[model samples]
Target chain A: MTDVASPHTDPEQKRGLFETLEIDTRLLGMIGAFILICLAFTWYTDGRFLSARNIFNLTIQTVSVAIMATGMVFVIVMRHIDLSVGALLALCSAVMGLLQVRILPQYGIPLGSPLIAPIAMAAGILTGAAVGALNGWLVGYQGVPAFIVTLGGLLIWRNVGWYLTSGQTLGPLDPTFLKFGGSEGTLGVTLSWIIGALAAAAAVWAVWRARQVKERHEFPVKPIGAEVALSVVIAASILGFVYFLNSYLIPDARLKRMFEARGEVMPEGYTEGFGLPISVVVVIVVAIVMTIIALRTRFGRYIFAAGGNPDAAELSGINTRWLTVKVFALMGILCGLSAVIAQARLQNHTNDLGTLDELRVIAAAVIGGTALSGGVGTIYGAILGALIMQSLQSGMAMVGAEAPFQNIVVGVVLALAVWLDIQYRKRTGALK
Target chain B: MTIETKIDPRGTPLVEMRDISISFGGIRAVDHVSIDLFPGEVVGLLGHNGAGKSTLIKCLSGAYHADAGDIFINGEQAVINNPRDARGYNIETIYQTLALADNLDAASNLFLGRELVTPMGFVDDGAMEAETRKIMARLNPNFRKFKVPVAALSGGQRQSVAIARAVYFNARILIMDEPTAALGPHETQMVAELIQELKREGLGIFLIEHDIHAVMKLCDRAVVMKNGARVGTVNVAEVTDDDILGMIILGKKPPQAV
Candidate 1:
């Protein structure tokens, strides 16, 4: 009789660094690629690309698409694709823009009123959800393929937004609403430091709690040194990000103008850096929430299960049809949230607001490791994917590349990333 | 020849599907079939391909709704609109295909719809894993690939996962469709032993099989069906292997059964 050995039972075999740390090798590869891209850009642009200001701008720029990409993870994980997110974003922006600029004022609610921003936001999100539900219904109950349904949505919603705004850009939106758009509002140096410290603490606590849970269940725990080292790395990276953002001091002229507007004289050498933009914060919150939803919720589990084997999931008594509706609706709500950030950043709603954004968001999710065939994805991966996509586009722009060339590079990179992922899966025998 | 222990047919049946009928695309896949099972009994359902044995059992397992029928659990009328409703009655099915989510780990597949949740309403993955480990230890101690997706598991191992899922739920009635089809000789023997163990613990099982030898050995009573209707059901002790074979191949009731 021969004894067949299981992979994990090889007690005498030495483990690799990543295995011991229990880090996802894919995630490590992505981070390495991101750093390499940054270094390349910095070298090409003569160090201007790696400046704190550029980094800050990059974070904000990644927000809207990144938010939608998180939702795309769920969509793709369920073996469904959403082609209307960009159009949905434009429609949502139009709804909010109209509410803020024309409708609210017509109803005698002043533009600067505190109620204006919230009202507009609510309407926009509701519109997004409604449209998303319609999409889901057509796909789930009516048996329309997601691709066709969302393709129709793409054309319909974009034109709907155009018609709503009468082909003219609507803007000078509420100042409160505009705050959600990157540079207009930021968490200053002190608050950014505070948030960084809190996040670090939370990260450490999560690790400790996970260890405790494993111990309670009598499961094997990671080496204490590894745990501590991981915690240190997480904390350092978080604080380092805050420090880097804090390095970009607000210009002297902007400070002077701010002081003049407030009816006060500017003090000598008075300067404060924008710690983190509100849009970036929105992306962070969305990413965290989406990750938790994917990892912790029953809805998330069912998505993977159904994607893996639809018949099995159905036999297990999962209401897979309803699940499809809920997933697309969630995607819709994200589009609405994304619209808020996009319009706020642009300070207006234009017909072309989210043009070609759908492709970018899908690319981000795919590049982040969400399998197109379904049943595999990670929220953090999608966010990082968005960051990578944004970096490539912005980097090429900074290096004086033409728009056509930028698109070509991005398209080639996306294909290469997917091919590499397939190769990786094949090597590990993780390919389905 | 198989020896059968006589059962006192005096109590309420554990499950009864009376006059069950189901159609697909206007084709009567299962027609006017009725079967009942008692506690601690193994009822073997035998038939050739397209004999409607699988289809008939699927109705009980909630995979299909009977176009016309009434189901009674413990002599009480039961409404099984779907697999969830069937599970609510403590009925579980180990499908022939194994019906496992290939991408999910064994624990996830085990608790697909009925997940253990924390007070915060999040899926309690660690607890589920602990429970899965405990069950696997009992059912198949050799099974140790708990972390990998079920797709990576061997055929025997996947069968064990499907069985473990059925057994862990404290099911009162089990419907096993070719449970040993994908298993090796040793795994098959293990399953036979498991059926005996489950029988001793008072779980009524509907065993769907094509192997007449296994039916003669493991079943107390064999119900044979052909072309969407029952031929006859006979006690294993009275019906020889040839007699059951006649019922499956010729769709005829043996004189002994009569």
Candidate 2:
């Protein structure tokens, strides 16, 4: 570390190219873990795990939890636990299902109307926000510990889900409504390629902007070769993902055979690509927006400050109580979004919807580098954490692992990841 | 800097804490302590552990509210219920802990609660960094850790950040708790110089210090407290180190204390 109080006249002041770049070790660790997990699964499954179809499916599978995990990062960063998010998802889904199945039908709204989906989605989000407001009220104004309040919420909301549907599953939603989470309604091949190109451009621009800032400040910067190499690596991964998704053949032979047998002639020159899953698109958008909020917003900074030291933040004139309320509220809205996607993907709303999801969400946030002790986390990191968790589960399932065994392995990995994080922090003297 | 040939005529009192008293649980932490500060004056508050100097200052800084008594600014009663209220009165406190967020870089910590934002409500980090650079350059020319968290900085660098935060916010009345406690001799001299600059700009400062030499060097008046009561307040120019020591250790007021 450079001494801020002393002029740097030492010969060692100039660092190696890589060292000057100063990438976060935690983020690099996550990327490495993700790649290793992918390789292990690919090897174990004899290349099937890395098949274009499976990778596309894996991205979709990671969506719901990934979205919620993004919000959970903020919650944990502010040193608060929200164990009720899973139950909140169930309650939100139940409300949407009930509105679609029982309530809206009586109002002469056609079951097949496209309007029903948006209305039901809005209702579900509002319901989640309401419950979140209640949680915030109890924790902030009533001075109840968040753990106890959310623990009570975890039970109460699940029970509410049960009561809403009388313990029966609800669904067979409108086909249009279901498209959000289905593979058929994706960002098609050309769009996926276009998006990949745009993302690569943005990445390059970000690097260039960072270099300019460093130069303007007269700080040491990475060599141009190193910077270009880093950007190329990022860009290649993104474009490669688009190419892989585009290669996954949809309407496989079996489906085509069935259609032909039904006397439906295939259109001439017709071609289908897997494209990007709509749920994955939703997750990507959520991740990008949340990352911006976390990095560039006043509310984001306040979250970290309040988490770092509530007393200090308070003395600095932040209304920590209101901030707590706002954070929970945001988490609640995210739960609502997760609910919609999960319900669509499952094609039904079970009373047990989102059970044990809180654990997975928390694990993802922690694995992604969100510190349990607070004031340290990032939205992108948490999203990657979710991806890592889902990949492990997906890979293990492909290898014919039992559910019990999978649970144990995931639990160990979560612990091991946190232990690694602690060691890293210790080495860096950033543990405090 | 030219040493003053004689003390300039005292300006109107900028702040007055009249008969302020606060009790925590069953303990009277600060008991009816009255103190006044004038523009461009540095008042040194000296006390042993649990001597109520911090508790009394906390009341004026709005970290704690007084159970009994009143605070007046420029002869007008001021209501200070929280730290926000204190800042509203241009009263800034640099806590002993420095109170910086360890996870955030220097520029972020400097503008934590009161962030500079673009018209779009996004935090203008570039603008804020530019401002921080300008201030750091003026205050601590050697400071170059603007991109790193305060936790990674040296003690003196952290002190500079805390002091810069207080001074940058247009603080007219400053409460600095052990500002130089963690600094080296060079840093201490830098702070001393900073204090003189603030004095020349006509800001009032309350300095809580243990180092008697620092008190003699920086303070115009020194107030000694013991057992939650004021022992005396004396003009530093008229009091010997031994005389102030007697007031602190023996609870004996000097002839002018009345």
Candidate 3:
């Protein structure tokens, strides 16, 4: 009784008050299971095993998936699929790299060639958007299934990447170009802290605007206990989480120490600054921006509506076809952006770089509770799913597990995530 | 006392269905029928399911054009080539399903097709919320909630959103297909009140109701149909449940009521 009545236990000021009020059993169980698994992992890893640095590594690696999953949330919400992301990424990276070719100075603008790089990146994004449009059009107007169109797109775009790179590697992107990713070094604490603050502000703005509209209309709102407390808890958690990362958002000041031993640098030692990589920053931006788009826009609502019932949306005077096409195109653009991040971080472009990335992205999305049939996903869920996936993979590798074994584990995990999601939907009566 | 008008050449009709016939290939569903609706009046369309009642309404709404009949809206002889065209001609049809996107909230649903836009051309969600507040205020004071997704709303709320969608678009003629079919008694009363409110606004509503009690309670006049033919159009005061029942069974008016 004493334990249960802790001063913090008062529902009014309770942290994570939303979780307790939830009627969805599946969600409750998923959350509970997730907590249990995390605890188990922590216990197994022990004090040294679960350090801040290791957790940070897990987070940084999953950033790309987290970002792609944000866009996937919108697409999945509309009951559509965008399979061209991997290929789109490849194509974008290829173009980005090719534009950096001072080897062909005449066509490559200048050695520091500022205009050419921006144009190339823009061209890559547009190409991705165009492919997405084609996918959307085929599905929306031509009555083709999104799966088939995107699948065909995957092959075509990958081929284009190979053709553009002529089956070769493009490298040494300009330092400024790489800085967008953090390739220059771990981002300054100022940038990380600023980005985190902006995210919190954005979240608060959306919540406030939506609530005001509801209040003006006298709609039923969550009880005040849940509302105000949840807001404070959420805001505080964001602040604290960001502060924790800010304290160590960058790699250790001596991360390069491992690269050197006994007063001699290893053959592959001497990595860049102890700071966070630029790719990490790019991924963070992607996650924040895309999640905002998914949650706040009318376009986002349309995606859910269209996913729930296409015929009904059409009858409601919605240009369902237009929405479908637009989402497909947007998905492609995200993929392209992901590809650019990959290219910059890798410091080189290769057709093979993005292979199987789609599977991982899809797995992360579904694991995050993106319903296969659609109209049920969120950016946070997808990003978390990706983090979980990458964490498991990293943990396995650290335990001396082979890639094949890790692959099997991931496959099983994906299936379980999907099964759990279906169960969750059913309990919530959403499956109906 | 309600104000009403029929000056646009009752023959020309705001909507005309002439010899409009449709068949499912081997069967002649709507053999031959004609109906006309003019401005500022309620027109009830009734019949059993197989009697082609829905088929006829579908033709008018452009869901299905009569395989043989011609549809003209707003006199001047028009062609409702498609549902989009029906909308262009200010003809709106509300189905039993309400045809609403359940995941969207009320304001979004109300302005589903024709959303208000900001100066920069993005969907003006705030303006839409305000406009919805204004419209729903006059019709239903109870409808104040705007942001909760329709999926979480009650059945009556869903219906309200659908109706508001059509009304917000300046639809002059509304063809509601069994709007009250699946509602509970209290909900039916609420909807009936909504209909009266629409009527008070001077909108011509073609309410399709299966329940004779509902039709008598809410409609100013009623039209009965059987076997793809008009049983008759009669004032509510002039008919009873027995009359509508007889019309449904025998395709004829009841003796005393007639």
Candidate 4:
């Protein structure tokens, strides 16, 4: 509504330069934390942590959780929580393994058939979605609290995974499906560059269109200088990311000396560059799509309104209960995707596949600035949160820190990020 | 075009709630109260807190269901099972608390449930913002904070957002539950002018108020209730402020009602 600024002050001039950036301090703080983590780890590991190969590995490690975190952002923003995602992921992948190893083979479908991969993936994703639908129905329609329903689901789904796998590991997956999660399926250097260029162009065009619309409506527009500066930073980041991936050589040149000491000559005609990891590409696609859903769709706005004040939303004629159901269902679908990626990357589905993953997914979302109290979140922020968490885990492992110590450090970081988020909200008076 | 085209030309009352009664936990909140609002009239409901004025209005606004009553819209019986049912008849209510999503910007709050979307089902934010600006320019011209959440707005501005949201959705019968209760004198006057503007455009309004002065200035007629029962309904010109106060405080009916 009305502003405190003087009437003569043009709307565009009301905000200061820093405010024009439209990047809140929470995001800046996350970005700051990311940079600090990278520098510290690089120093501690004598540059091994920041090596292109390890950075690529870290990106790969972040992929599954980042995908799940994107969906978790919506669930949390709608004032609900899902503690069953990790269990659901394990169960879905186990079901896929079951279909591949026992059921499908009994139906006369041979292993490694290209069709087997698609069928297995579909079956796995469907199983997860179906379980999610049940959760939604119980919580949304039966008036059960989400926390209770999903906590129950966490136990039931994990046990179901164990039963499906007969308490044993299953896989050495179809070679075709494995490619989606491995280096052999990556986009080469030239393709990565092309994709980066296209993304940069889209970013610039989006900014330009937004500015045009603001001008047309006589609303406050971010200054042109700020827009250009933002676009340049975006373009530079994309290109720099492509360059970093391209710099890493596949089969790891770092291991060449060890091979020489073993009196083995380097294999001729080995493919050299580690282009973009396919898993990273999957995460990016999911992030982009989920971001659009959160920011552009009517359903997305309803999620925020319902989460912010269910009473007000209902008075405004929203079906808050049904919206909650839909949100959970969407989360279920994302869990399915994460399952496929997880199974492919490991080439196996064990009883422990995706165990404790729900905590990591939730931590990433909260650390990325999504409030646990609801009505606030972003898909990109959650993805960044996932990356930040994985970077810490990978760096600590590279530095030879014990697993227990790594867990303690990660737990502290998650707590600190949330504390910082609360402080930022308080400083800006955005906290209700 | 002027807003006059949207008004019904027939001289019929827009809404009528007859013998409406409801109880909560063995306590009757609204007992056999009947009220009517004609097009182009501002009818003020005057009562002390818990005297059932709000309860009676909530039934009309579809926030509550009446246990023993019939509601007629344009002389036809209507079933209002929920808030959505209320909106289907173009009835909108501005609650005493304003009922806005505090975290969302004014434009988003303005079009919460009934969002205008592109053919692709994406909310058309640009169109919605431009439309919000257009309406606010008419209702409260000083409004310009289209970006910040409504929580950051001043009381009057939040009221303006609530009012604009109600007015924008083609609501023919509007309910205001103490619309200016928390506002300063200047903001109060702004809301008064806005009510008068709506009256001129031929929309029926129910102005619930504790401020007798506000009722005297803005209402064409006053209906006073006490202890869940109607004391009387009188034209503002026919009664002094003291007369309404006596009805509210003493539960005494005027000659006409008796």
- In terms of TM-score, which candidate is strongest? 1
Per-residue lDDT tens digits of candidate 2, residues A1-432? 113466662223755444577677678888999999999999999999999989889988889999999999988988889999999999999998898888888898757987899999999999888888888878877899889999999999989899979998997776676877757468778898898899889988998987887677665677788889889988998889989989887766744774698999767666678788778778888998898888889888899898887887888888888888888998999999999999998887898888999999999999988898999898888988999999989899999999998989899999998999899887666775
User: Could you tell me every candidate's TM-score relative to the true structure?
Assistant: 0.96, 0.92, 0.77, 0.91
TM-score of chain A of each: 0.96, 0.93, 0.81, 0.92
Over the stretch A90-201, how does candidate 1's per-residue lDDT look in tens digits? Answer: 9999999889888999998878999999999999999888998888888888989999999999999989998988988997889999999998888899999999899999
In candidate 2 chain B, where is summed lDDT lowest over 10 consecutive residues? B1-10
Docking level of model 4: acceptable
CA RMSD (A), model 1: 3.1
Please provide, for model 4 over A132-231, each residue's C-alpha lDDT reduced to its tens digit, 9 standing for 90 to 100. 8888889888999999999999999989889767798887778777866756467877888888899889988988888897788777777678889888
- Candidate 4 per-residue C-alpha lDDT over B1-258 given as tens digits, one digit per residue, 9 for 90 to 100: 011112435565789888899999999999888888899899999999999999999888878999998898987999997888999999999999999998899999999988889789888888899999898887777777887778767777788899998999888999999998898877788788878989999899999999999999999999999889888888898878888888999977666542
Q: Which stretches of candidate 3 lie over 4 Å from their true place?
A: A1-39, A47-52, A101-106, A110-112, A180-185, A194-277, A402-405, A426-431, B1-34, B48-91, B114-149, B152-157, B164-171, B189-197, B209-258
Q: Which stretches of candidate 4 lie over 4 Å from their true place?
A: A1-14, A252-270, B1-11, B23-28, B226-229
lDDT of 3 by residue, A354-395 (tens): 777778888888888888786678776787788778877887
Top-DockQ candidate index? 1
Model 4 residue pairs with clashes: none
Question: Worst 10-residue stretch by lDDT in candidate 3 chain A?
Answer: A1-10
The interface root-mean-square deviation of each model, in the order shown, is 3.5, 4.1, 11.2, 3.0
Native-structure RMSD, model 2: 4.2
**lDDT of model 4 at position B132:** 92
Can you list each candidate's DockQ? Answer: 0.48, 0.41, 0.26, 0.42
Off by over 4 Å in 1: A1-17, B1-8
